[model samples]
Target: MLSYIYALAGQFQLTHERLSDMPAAPPVLLSDRQTEVLKWAAAGKSRGVTADIMNISEAAVDDHFRRIFKKLNCNDKVVAVLRAMSSGIIHL
Candidate 1:
């Protein structure tokens, strides 16, 4: 799986800067689950649909959004997506 590959790769000497080419990118500090949730968010997925696809509860999806918003310092989803795009975490 992708998470397993990233985990295996993390055991080596490469650091965050080497992991991401963009200067404005945020540190690669998110957990795999968080990254997955963010990717879904970036794709314009609603909380309920994302939860169904991810096999998590709607409340769990809300919880992820709360953490994501706080972490990215975004007041809303639009700002979150913009911030994430600027940070090279995703492209739209």
Candidate 2:
């Protein structure tokens, strides 16, 4: 019974290691402009400022955030930025 237990434990360990070795799911896809918007947002920039810096209109920035929210599956910019950072979609 002890040997059987050990064998089961060994198999479990190998399975656990194999699972860990598996690649993570691909990150959510975002457009280049969306990424830029999220990057600016991560840096604590407001949409207005990001628009000014990116030389786009505020409405354009708003549109980007709307799409970003959909892509990242988040409603708020802060959550979207956090998800993007965590998912390797964007860096700080």
Candidate 3:
């Protein structure tokens, strides 16, 4: 039983190391609409305001943000904007 436990622990360590070494997915290019939305967001516009200015629904703005986050691998608006800018996906 002790040997089995040690073997299991070794296996877990190996799996963890392999997973940690795995490279992240490559960045995806943003669509024109997505870049537009990110530009508005970077300008400090709220989603509602962006939606109003773009003549799009608030839900559509949210959807755009969601896709942006996914493409940028960000979990928050600030990070998403930063990533978008740094990646040349959007400009000020």
Candidate 4:
């Protein structure tokens, strides 16, 4: 699951970089899991479905989202998604 998440995130990150109209981040690094969570969130997947797709619990998804918010310095899911997009960590 982790590997899938990581690869998926990297793929979306590259896609987001090529697509979004937002400013990119200054190359800040994130853990593979964090990037994955951000990618799903940015792509508008709810916590439960993301959890299912990742084969994790919904609570685990929420927990990851909290961690993602902290790592990205974002206040909420929307901001986190925007940040993820801007940072090329998720596609629009």
TM-score of each: 0.63, 0.70, 0.69, 0.62
**Candidate with the greatest lDDT versus the true structure:** 2
Error of 2 at 33 (Å): 0.4
> Candidate 2 on 7-61: residue-level lDDT in tens?
4564564456447966654569999999999999878798799999999999999
lDDT of 1 by residue, 1-92 (tens): 86445434442313453467735535535556666777887787988899999999999988877887788765466556555665667766
Model 4 global lDDT (CA atoms, 0 to 1): 0.72
Clashing pairs in 1: none
Candidate 4 wrong stretches, greater than 4 Å: 1-27
Cα lDDT computed for each candidate against the true fold: 0.67, 0.78, 0.76, 0.72
lDDT of 3 by residue, 1-92 (tens): 86456545645644564479677457778888888898997898998999999999999999988888888766567666766665567777
Q: Which pairs clash in model 2?
A: none
lDDT of 3 at 79: 62
> If the candidates were sorted by their TM-score against the true structure, best first, what order would they fall in?
2, 3, 1, 4
Better of 3 and 4 by lDDT: 3
Model 4: per-residue Cα lDDT at residue 46? 83
